[model samples]
Target: MYWRTREELSLENRLRRSYYELLRDELDQFIMAHALKESYENFKNNNVAYPFVERKELKPRARIPKDEFSLHNSFLVIFVEDTIPQAYKKYIRFFDVNKTTKTNLLRSKTLSLGPDFDRSQKFLDSVHFYHFLKELLPVDYALLIQRDTSHAKTKHRYYLSHFHVRIDWPISEAAEDLARYLRYISKDVYEKGEKYAEDVQKKFFEYHALPDMIGGRRTAASVAAQYLRRLPFISTVYVSSSESRSLYRYCEQGVSRMVLMRLTTGEMEQVADRNNMPVRELKRFYMLDQNGRGGIFLFRVTYGHTAPAMPPEDGKLREIKPELFWITVKYQHLLPLPGIWEHPPLRVNLIYT
Candidate 1:
C-alpha cells in the first residue's frame, strides 16, 4: 500500500512487520533443521556434534574466516533529500556516464568516489536514487527503504529518503529489527517485488564512511544513537556488540574444535565442548550466533509516559542511574529526566563515538 498518512504508514509498518515475522519463523525453522543435520553428520564423521554449528561464515569477506569477525560494519545509513548541500556537491557526480561505462568502472574492482552528483540536480529523482544505490552496493546487499515524507511540521517534510543499506546477503541473515524499515518508494516496485535498473555493480567506496569522512569521525550507528538519546521522544537505547570478541569463548565445544580444525590440526582432540548452557543464559551465545552482537535498539517515549517536565514524586523516580548519566550528561543537557526510563545496559559502549 502507498502510505499517504501517518496512520496508513503505521498500519503498513505493522502489517509488514507481521509478514516479516512469519518469514523469520520459517527461516529459523529451516536453519534449525539444517544445523541439526550438520551436527549429526559431524558426529558421525568426527564423533561429536556442536549444539549450534554454523558451517558458513555469517558475514564472509572474500571467503576468509578469523577469530574476530565484524557484522554490520559494511552498512551505511543515509538521509537523502531532494536538494544537495553546497559542500556535498563535490562528492556527488551527475548521471553522464553510459551504461557500459558504469559497468566497466565497477568491474575495475577498485574503490571509487562513485558517480559525482553535481550535475544530477535537475534530473534526480527516485530512479536516480535507486541507480545510485544499485552502483553503490554489492550483489548481496539488502536495500531497506524508509520514505519520510510526512511530519507534523510542514518544513520537516522534505520528502527525504532515509536508507539503511547493508553490503551483505539477505535481510533474514541480518538483525530482524531492520526489517521494520523495509518499504518501497513506489507502488509499482512494491507490487513487482523487483526493481530493474541495468543491475548496478558492487564496489567499496567512500560513501560508506559517511559522517566519518565528513569529519564526524563516528559510525552511522554512533551518530544515530547520539542524536536519538537527547530527544524527549526517546525513552531508552539498548546497544549490543556486533562482532565476535573471542572465537573460543563464543563458539560451542564442537564449533571450537571445528574452528581449530580449520585453523590448525594439532589441538582438535584437546578441545572439548563447553558444559551445556542453560536456556536463560544463552543470550550471549544467541547474540554471537545471530551476528547481532552489536545492535542499537531504541525505545521511544509513548503518550502513557509522564511528561518530560514532571518527575515522579518518589525519590527513586527522580534518581537517575549513574550509568545512564554518561549518555544524558554527555550531550550537556543538565535537565533531570522524567521518571520513566530504563537503565542502560552495563556492558554497552555508552560513548559510541
Candidate 2:
C-alpha cells in the first residue's frame, strides 16, 4: 500500500491532487456525456504507421461485421503540440486494460509516431507521456510505447520498455503533481546540464565496479561469507563509522549499497513484536547516512511492492514512503562505514546542508 507522511498533507499536495482529479473527472464526464464507446475504427490513416485495414485487407478469420466491431478497450488519445522543429503531432494512447505480462491490471498502450516526428523528441516525449499518465491516472502498473524511423541504424521500430512505474497505494492529488513535477525537472536538468549528467553516469559506473574492486568474485563472496558466518548470532549488522564515511562520498557521488543479512524466523518474530508490525510485511531494510556527519537512520524494509512507506511518529524514524524510499535507498546507502552496527544502530549527530 502507498504511504504518506502527515507532513505531506500540506496545501501543495492538496492543490495538485485537486488539479489532476478535476482534469480527469472532467475528461471522464466528457466521454460519458458524449456516449463514447470502448471500440471503434479509425479511418484516418494519414501516416505510414498504423496503416488502415480496409474491408479487403481484413483477415478472414478476424473479420467481423461493422455493426459488431465495438472497441472493447477504453483509450485516451493524447495529441501533443511540438516544442521543437520538424516534429509534428505526437499521439499517446492510453488503454484501460492489462496487456503487460507482469501485472495484469495496469493501463497500457502504444504511442504512434506522427509524420515529421524527431527521433530524440520521440524518445523524450515517450518518457514525458509515461510520467504524465502515471500522475493523471495512478495505477499499480503502466507502460509507454515509442516509435521512430529516423535512426539510420535501427529502422522504423517500437521501443516497448521506455519507462514504467507502479502506484500501488492511493495518493493525494498534490503528491502526484509533485511527483510529476520532479520527473519533469529531472528530465529538464538532464537535457540542460551536460556536465552534471555525465558526472552522474561516471559515478554510477564506479558503483557498479565495487563488486569487482573488493576482490573479484572471491572477495565479493567473502563479504557474503563474512555475513553468513555471523548470521547465527546477529540478526543484522550496522555499518561502522569508517565505512559510513566512504559510503557518504559514494552517495554524494551517487553510488548505492545493499545491506546483507539473514534473519532467523525467531529474530524476525522478535522484530515484528518490537515494531508491532507483521512478519511478512518486511521487505527491504536500510540505514541512512545523513549528510557527512555519520548520522544513521534505520528504515523499515518494504519491498518495492507498493507506494513509499510513511514515517513513524517524530518523523525521525519511519518506514520509507514508497515514492521517496527507493530513491533514498538507492542513493543514500552509498555511505561507507567501519562495521555493521546491530539493530537500533546508534544514532549519530544530525547533519543537514
Candidate 3:
C-alpha cells in the first residue's frame, strides 16, 4: 500500500489522541469507592480499622477470597453523586461479575475496565460486598449472634456474641432501601438502642432450659471437676451470665443471674416432701449441697442432648448477643477447659466502657 503523506498521518494521529483523551476524562468521572476509616469508640479496644475499596485496586477482584456464610443477607444502601471533573460519581451501574459468587458489590466497577458498564444509580450491596462491608460489620455480626435457627427438627440456639453499638451513618432507611436487610428480619436485634437482647434471651433460656449451676471461684474449676467426677454419669454444664441490657457504659450492677442445678423426678418429690408441698406447687427448687444446707436452684435437663460441650470459637462469639460467656464440665473427670471468661473469644465488651 502507498504510504500516506506525513501531514495526513500526523492529522490522523491527533484525531486518535483526542478521542482517547475524551474516553479517559469520561472514565475519571467515576471514582472507585473505598471504605473510610472510622474509630469504633464503643469497642473496648477502641479504634478499630474500617476498610474501603477502590477501582485501581480491583483488577484481581475475581480472585479475591471469600469467607464462609459470606452470602448472608447483609444489605445496604449506597448513595453516590453525579458530578463532573472526577469529583466522584454518585452512583455505579450494577456489575455482576460472578453471578454464582455474588460477594463483592464493586465487581462491576472493577470489571468495568474490560467491557461492562451498567450506569444504574441504584444497586444492591449484599453481605459479600467488601467495599463498604467493614463499615457495618459489627452491626451485622451482632445480628448473627442472636439468630435462632432452631426449627421443628433442629433447635440450635446462637446467643449474641459481641456487638458494639454504632451511631454513625444513616441507617434508619436501611430496611426500606434494600431487599435483603437483615436487621428487619432479625428477631434478636432491637430497633436502635433498645434493650431487646434480655427479653429475647430470657424466652430462649426458659424454653430450652439451662442446667442449674454451682457457685464458682478461680479454684472452682478444680472443685467442680472433683464434684462432678463422682456422679453416676458424665454431666455437661453450661455457664453464662444473664443477658443484660446494653447500649450504655457502666451498667448499674445488680444480681442478674440464678445458679441452677439439675436433679431428678424422685429428687424433686423428696424435696417437695421436705418443703411440705406438692412437686408442682414447689416454688423454689434449690436445696442444700451434698450436706443439704445451702439453697441452689434446680434445673432438670429436659433434652436428651446438651449444647456443644466445648467453647464456641471466636467466630461464634464475635456476634453480639446475650448468653453465658463461660462454660465448663467434668466429662469423665477431665480438667475443665477455659471458659469464655478465662479465655475470651472476642475482646469487644458491651457492658463496660
lDDT leader: 2
Worst 10 residues of 1 by lDDT: 197-206
Q: Highest TM-score: which candidate? A: 1
Worst 10 residues of 2 by lDDT: 240-249
What is candidate 2's lDDT per residue for 1-353, written digit by digit as tens?
12233356567545533443343333332222121111111211222221112222111112222321122222212211111112211211223233222233232433333454333432322444333333322222223333334474543233322222221221122222222222322333244355534433332222222221221221222222222221111111111111111111111122222222223355445555665556443322322222232222231111121122222334242221212222222221111122233333222111111
What's the distance in Å from true for residue 26, model 2? 21
Query: lDDT of all the models against the reference?
Result: 0.23, 0.26, 0.23
Q: Report how far off residue 127 is in candidate 3 (Å).
A: 30
- Report how far residue 225 has shifted in candidate 1, in Å: 4.5
Candidate 2 residues lying further than 4 Å off, grouped into runs, are 1-13, 18-200, 204-262, 277-353
In candidate 3, what are the lDDT values of residues 1-353, reduced to their tens digit? Answer: 12122355466444533443342222211111110001111221344321211112221111212221211212121111111111111111121232212233244232222235232211122222232323333221111111123353322222211122111211222211211121222322343245443333232222122222212121121122222222222222112211110010000110011112323456556656764666554322233122133222212111111233222343242232345322222111101111112221111111111
Q: Model 2 residue 55 lDDT?
A: 22
If scored against the real structure, what TM-score would every candidate get?
0.23, 0.19, 0.15
Model 1, residue 249: distance off in Å is: 25
Model 3: residues >4 Å from true position, as ranges?
1-253, 283-353
Query: What residue runs in model 1 are displaced by over 4 Å at the alpha carbon?
Result: 1-67, 70-73, 78-219, 225-319, 323-353
188-265 per-residue lDDT for model 1 (tens digits) = 212322322100001000111111112111222333322222222211111111121111100000011011112111
